[model samples]
Target: MSIQKIISTKSNLVTELLQNIAIEEDWAKIEQFTIALIDNFKDPRILPGLVEKINTLPFDEANAFLVYACGEYSLEDCKVFFDLWIELVAMGDFHTASNAGFILANLPEPFDFNERQLDQAENKLMLALSKPVTEEKALVIKEVLELLK
Candidate 1:
């Protein structure tokens, strides 16, 4: 299956579908799509196209699953995604924030983050930390902060 098929050609509507899937907590579908992306990730065209689609998404909520799936790439392939995750985390949706945090924390080694990116991520993380979230997500955010330090 092609990446376009696995993800969706209708960039504007994919967010609604993803939001429903996230709200339903459909692990199988999410994993199925992610695995498909992983299978196709080595293809020369996948990441950039996927990143472009993600960049065009309307809101951070739309990015949660895609970001989580993309987290498996090597740092070399991951650089393109890291900035988007910073933006997602800055939006402070707990699902996206924690998933972004998890990805950031698990990078092969720390990246030299951009100053503005670092500032936004730190501010949002600290804000999200002060709010109520699942204990698990809270832990992930805390670990991400430590990783950033």
Candidate 2:
């Protein structure tokens, strides 16, 4: 089957859709589609906002999206995302922070954080890292960190 067809599955459809759009170099569509998806995440009518948020997240916004998807996490969950951000910080790039806010704006409540909230950002990254890092994602995060460092 075509790549697009394969990505049509519900499980990873959103991620795959974004990936295809990214590969096609279609930022405009990505941004627009993402905006709507993000909005849905803010106040989901169907599934939990996190579910859709995680689905639509592309590689570009994985960290932010992952944190957002995890929702109002316990201390343990916060650490996963925090450690990941630190690795990003050590690389001297703050784009992760930007993405974090982008993802945060769509959260339901309580867990929502502002852009300048480094403490919260750190927590999110730690939360992400604490979880089992998939092989594909691990490679990408490592590469980005290396490039930034």
CA lDDT of each candidate?
0.62, 0.41
The candidate 1 region of ten consecutive residues with least summed lDDT is: 12-21
1-149 per-residue lDDT for model 2 (tens digits): 88776545543545544444345335465445555444433222212333334334443444353343343332333333443434443222234444433333333445433455555444545465566665544444444333222
Clashes within 3 Å, all models in order: 0, 21
Global lDDT of model 1: 0.62
Give the root-mean-square deviation of each candidate in angstroms: 7.4, 13.4
**Cα lDDT, model 1, residue 3:** 84
TM-scores of all candidate predictions against the true structure: 0.57, 0.30
Best by lDDT: 1
Residue runs of model 2 more than 4 Å from their true location after superposition: 1-24, 41-79, 95-149
